[model samples]
Target: MPNSSEHPCRITIGDDGPLLVEGPVEVTCADGTVAVSDRFVVALCMCRRSRMYPWCDTSHRRRTQPGEKSRRDTG
Candidate 1:
């Protein structure tokens, strides 16, 4: 079987933030790695700007200084 989500999960998407998943949840990365969280809720990084890769640390909220361009703005 193809390696992908086979079951359903309740995920909440933000306009410019991480995906919120109610925990405890288990996640499998594209690299064949896995991560889990037993917290009441989990924030999965969508911007990939998090130091906590796979998990969000509100890094997406970081603002670039004047004259500095952000990655998302470049695309």
Candidate 2:
């Protein structure tokens, strides 16, 4: 998790894929590591294909086409 001073950000799960995280957040990994960024807004990788894990690499787009199998159990 990011520092509380960062003010945090809002993450919205798109209907397709790719979580949209908007600014002021300090996104952290499973190990409690935080991402270094000078900016506020950032798009995180939810599909787990990003060379920059936790950041969007557009892999989700490939997994979610018009008629592809949905791997995520949103429920």
Specify the highest-TM-score model's number: 1
User: In candidate 1, how many clashes are counted?
Assistant: 0
Error of 2 at 40 (Å): 4.5
Candidate 2: C-alpha lDDT: 0.69
After superposition, the stretches of candidate 1 with alpha carbons farther than 4 Å from their true spots are 1-9, 64-75
How well does each candidate superpose onto the true structure, as a TM-score?
0.68, 0.56
Evaluate candidate 1 by giving its C-alpha RMSD to the native, one decimal. 8.5
Could you give candidate 2's per-residue lDDT for residues 1-75 as a string of tens digits?
454656554668877667776664567799998985545567778778788877776776644665667866464
Cα shift from native, residue 32, model 2 (Å) = 2.8
**Model 2's TM-score against the true structure:** 0.56
How does candidate 1 score on lDDT? 0.82
Give the deviation of candidate 2 from the true structure as CA RMSD. Answer: 8.4
Tens digits of per-residue lDDT for model 1, 36-56: 888877999999888987899
Residue 14 of model 1 has an lDDT of 76
